[model samples]
Target: MSDFFEALPGAVGSPPQHYGNPLGEQKILVDGSAVVDLGHRGIVTVSGSDRLTWLDSLTSQSIAGLQPGDSGETLQLDINGRLEYAIRVVDDGDTAWLLVDADEAAGLLAWLSKMRFMLRVELADRSADFATIGSLGTPAIEAAAPNGVPLVWHDPWSSVVRGGHQYAQVAEHPGAEWSYSETLVAPSALAAASALPVAGTLALDALRIAAWRPRLATEADEKTIPHELDWLRSAVHLTKGCYRGQETVAKVHNLGHPPRRLVMLHIDGSDGVLPAPGDPVAVHDASDIADAAIGTVTSSALHYELGPIALAVIKRGTEHDAELAILSDGIRIAAAQEVIVPRDAGAEANVPRLPRLGAVRR
Candidate 1:
């Protein structure tokens, strides 16, 4: 057994293991815990004289309300109010850090820079200078950390401070008992720090699916408005002033109902294989596929706790708990709807309606 697994009590006796493939010889030893190399997650540093004000004007969240030690979630949307990127912002005195999914960082940075030609804010890609790890449901191991590391307790999840400067983001799930912690560390000392069992991108995907957390470039589509993805409560500040996409955001929330809704998929064990992202999800009525395609699968994972699950965006009013099928590469996978929220409920009726824009689309 590896030292990392050995350090875990009782884990060495009967370590959880999973086969990478049904017919593959190699097996992945599950330690009941795993560390994800979040190197792919990128960080953006916004500093200079007007960092806070500048960011506040651009993002969907209220930046001025943030305190020195606090963190908040925000989204950057295009002029049409389509979500471009989602970020977790942490404030530390004069500088604020924006952490975003790895794939969307470059595009988001470029867009922000273009709008920052004369602004006092400076934007730099600090992804290469930092390391991040996400640990879930393993409080015992985190509680055993040495005192030297700066640890921040945000209720359900705690972050171990690594490197010279550290910042942590913690949040509790609204309807679930799960807790998540995201820790940012300086790249220089990351390799030497005590290792946590590493979880591959696959494991993280499964965890997110089970949690029903929506992500950008996947669960969120180019046609998706923030309200449709149910991101307003956490990602957007409705009270905040004008932004690139505020008008559309408000309109959708108030007057218009989002054409699509985020849904969870419970895949049947009898299916031959799980569908990948971008696969078309449809309703199977006896012998024929439904005429109207329901939605697209964004992320799919084999959950450690819930077997096979996926997060998808389906048309609103679709029947919950109804059996469906996901098709990809001539293979049909069986799926069922698991609604995250009912169609007509809290916050849906109160969203502000779009103001008249006089012939021109805002």
Candidate 2:
């Protein structure tokens, strides 16, 4: 931990959620003049000649072809195709750096270690060796190069990569304007980096939600599939050969729709309180006797540009034009849904459907 960050005014918690002014910090951060302390994140390193191929065989993205300084994101799914892990990957030829949520590092490392039976790959949890700092522009800190490899992971959410698919049909995606990256630097360098303009996770998250970026820590539940978040836009390689859960991925994209879809909520801030994750997202019946549970708020933030916005995952059958409401702490906050993944998304192969077994031909 950086003594400078710990001693900063209004600093609190292990990661310093904010330094006095979160919204102000967000404003500067969006202007590309501030860095956010992300020391709470976790880092893992994979090395060995087979590192790339080994990862390729286990993840949703095509990793075998990544070269030095190449960046990508990948997902680890359960056999049923529910998301288990989401990883930010950057390769430096000799080693691959994996940046993940702090809570996920240990479990991910254990899972990977169990899978490395005969592969000549080595894995290490490097969170203690380096701290993560994020910026909207190029990283403000000089990245560490302990092994002659600069460790910085440029975010790929700005655009879809090859073999990746986008489910959103908007004329323009908000993520196009997002320029985010995370840099790993020595703990000793944090104090020096903190000398520059600084933001906090709250600011970073507000920007992230505005960008329509799906973060694993919040966006995913045990039942989440990549398609629901449109994660294939930058994370999954649809054409990539077999990997864990690939079967379900291909099947869903080719012939089925995800049971749920992601949406951005323009929350009514009249209550002067932001809705937290897991809040019920619903719609009132015409009689007003009941409220239909459509989804749950997954992430929420007060963005500098957009106030009190949130992301939710709702039932695929939820009417797109329906008026939505968020129930938080016994207060009902009206919300307007901005579609992230359209209800009609998927079945990209356009396979012709067959008539029902008992249907009579007209």
Candidate 3:
């Protein structure tokens, strides 16, 4: 058993407890005056005469409205409106920096480059040159941004700001009332901040699951659309002009309902284990497991405060209080549904419906 799992009380399973680095309690990182290292987050630069217009036409958010020093989250969709990538777009007057998942940076750059036939847009990966760090809670926020610079404090997600000439500070998984900032500092400064515990990718994943925030590739699937994940208000811009797959976004949102939907899962902590991403989540009361398969687990974690929690994508009408299960090699892990977004939000009401999935009509 790895030191990480050896320190824990649960039994270590097939996938070794440490696939990468064993991030200890140091995973959370905060300790009065400590600095921590944020795992793989990369930056993509988009520059050209038609940068704004080109990006505006491709992403789900309204990039045309972005002003200098402003940043927002946007989704890059495939031809069918399926999410290819979720990125934080930051405009710094001269260049537009896209902060994307490290794993997707190369693919995103290649895809965007191929599509730039005549458009004056250049896309390049800037991951090696930047470091992303998370600064959370009241103290971290104050320390990161001492002077209120007319910044927007949107909660339950990360936000960013360029530091010096080569660094940017971004927020990561801002949960409920808690706040965090992802600092993109220079590599030289990292050693100075080494005293701060380095946070592992697992900790960030757990934080995201606990907060019920959907992640790319995990919570989001090719068959899945943003609206079903309740990303309309955050990642999609209903008022924005046309983009690839805008038709599907408009059609489903205005005339049809998404086949599946995202929801929160609160696991029975007594079970002593949490389900991994891609695990099947079943409705326990059903006689046939296949028939009751409502969704797949996207992200999950054992929170210090919330115990085992997860974000899942289930059929729209699945009973909220229905008993849930995570099946792995004949082992049935118990779970329960916990609705994060209310069914009757005004924004969801405006969604157009067609071939509805018994989606609630407000």
Candidate 4:
């Protein structure tokens, strides 16, 4: 977005892709002392004494208890609870700040304004007023967040949060130590990042996917629900008061199966090529033409440590040990499924048997 950024030394790439040395830069960026200009991200601010309650009533998180300097995430769904947008949020007493996709900023702002009604809330799309900077391991926004409140939304994906559930049966999440932060900065603050080793969306994405992070850019679909991407880890609070899509969420989580489930694919790197998003994912069969695609690749990246890896949403009925193949740019690449969301995702079948009568643990 800034020609100035392109001209910086080692800043040698375009937006929405890799910049600088990806792996080398990643080490620096994650150290918490460096910054990554999330220019592709947008910012919105909701200010007023009523901001917390108003937002809590509209989204899928329990945010009325959010205090100044507190941070979290929320989802905006349609009346039927289909996702419309995802937001990273923080409140600094005077303002409730939102970090969202830049492309959706205008629409989200307009929607929020129309919903104000008689509420004492003030809303503004502040993308023009501020830029976003991200860091992990330490606080890089101290120089920018004047209040020293951080205004940083710490990522809570690593642990099972209150009112949330985990679908990944792994004892420890690969991203368990993924302590990251994103904060608002003025254009002037971008100067701070220019001097540090730089990493871009591409680097961030590779690490994110490897950690099994469900990002809106890749994981969400038209009919996508929280259960599919295991997003309930942080974004949805089950015990929270009703919000749009809450009924659908509850119905599916408690009684129904998410038609599809997310998985990680360890793509064969023999060709040294990667599949693009939406590439057809078919059942792997060397003996015949691959059966009709059972799923599609949602995101793919060549991680420095894991090599070619991807995330896909396949039918929940797909065998957990199914061999998969991805058709990419005309070449068929082999893929092995690493279960992220179990096949029986929506059903919790571990109900223990009763001792004397048909009783169960509360």
**Cα TM-score of candidate 1:** 0.75
Between candidates 1 and 2, which one is better according to lDDT?
2
Better of 2 and 3 by lDDT: 2
How does each model score on lDDT? 0.62, 0.89, 0.61, 0.80
lDDT of 4 by residue, 1-362 (tens): 35445676666555525465777656665665656667777888898889999999999888888887888888898876677888888888878888887888898999998899999999988887766766776553443464456567778777777888888889878878777777676667666655665577777777788888888867887888888898888888988898888998888887778888899999999998798899888789843323588889999988887889999988899898889999888789999999998977765545565587766647
lDDT of 2 by residue, 116-194 (tens): 9988899999988888889998745788887677888889999998899999889999999899999898877887888
Error of 4 at 74 (Å): 1.0
lDDT of 1 by residue, 1-362 (tens): 12333243333121222213311111121333544445557778787878888888988877766666567767888899998888787766666777787767787789889989787888889776656555554322332112233222221112211111111112443224335555665544444332544444565556556656677757876787776666764677766789999888777665666677877888986755877898888886634443446878888877666677888888777776678888767677788877764464223347576768686665
Clashes of each: 3, 0, 16, 1
Reference-based TM-score of each model:
0.75, 0.96, 0.75, 0.91
Error of 3 at 173 (Å): 13
| Cα displacement (Å) at residue 175, model 4 | 2.3
**Which sections of candidate 2 miss by over 4 Å?**
284-291
lDDT of 2: 0.89
lDDT of 4 at 263: 94
Better of 1 and 4 by lDDT: 4
Stretches of candidate 4 off by over 4 Å are 139-143, 146-148, 286-291, 349-362
lDDT of 3 at 39: 45
lDDT at 257, model 2: 98
